[model samples]
Target: DAPVPSGAKGTYALTIEPLTAIPLYASRTLTSSDPSGFTVQTLPNDRGLVSVPSTSEDLSILQK
Candidate 1:
């Protein structure tokens, strides 16, 4: 594992299977009584945000 110090910058590459979708609240029920329509609806706290910046530079040279 590579650790970067505070105020430092680094570039890294990772290869893995991309995430499709996550099934949330698929295990337990949500309500106390008569959980037919009023099933337990829970929302987890906001974790983080991610985005890929749009670039106009051609990256075909990196393929080979």
Candidate 2:
């Protein structure tokens, strides 16, 4: 993880690539139950992720 300087803005990209080709045969559809209109999501929400600090931090404080 890379942290931007405090009080500064930074742009970063986080990418994930699988070693095995994702099976094109597997797929699923998600739809909202609301009857007012049509709403659909075609992809799963689980994008592999990790939590990290947004700015440089004094992690040593944790040792106290």
Candidate 3:
């Protein structure tokens, strides 16, 4: 997670990986802004994960 400077625009990236079949969710709250505004975001409807095979040599050894 990251914070944007006051009166500045920025972006943040979030990643989640669930080994099980269960669903995953994320949430964040911005207490205050440059002008003292509050914001919040919940990720049940905005977060997801993708699966990829291990192809790196070191990771392949661990898998075996």
lDDT of 2 by residue, 1-64 (tens): 3333345566745444456887433233333455644433334334567766688778898999
- Full candidate order by lDDT, most accurate first: 3, 2, 1
Q: Which 10-residue window of candidate 3 scores lowest in summed lDDT?
A: 1-10
Candidate 1: C-alpha RMSD to true structure equals 16.1
Clashing pairs in model 3?
none
Backbone clash numbers for all candidates listed = 1, 0, 0
lDDT of 3 by residue, 1-64 (tens): 3445466566655677768999776778767745888778674544455566776456666677
Q: Name the candidate that leads on lDDT.
A: 3
**Clashing residue pairs, candidate 2?**
none
Tell me the deviation in Å of residue 6 in model 3: 7.5
Query: Order of candidates by TM-score, top first?
Result: 3, 2, 1
In model 1, what lDDT does residue 38 have?
41
Candidate 2 residue 17 Cα shift, in angstroms, is 1.6
Q: Higher-TM-score candidate among 1 and 3?
A: 3
Work out the TM-score per prediction.
0.19, 0.21, 0.40
Error of 2 at 45 (Å): 16
lDDT of 2 at 46: 48
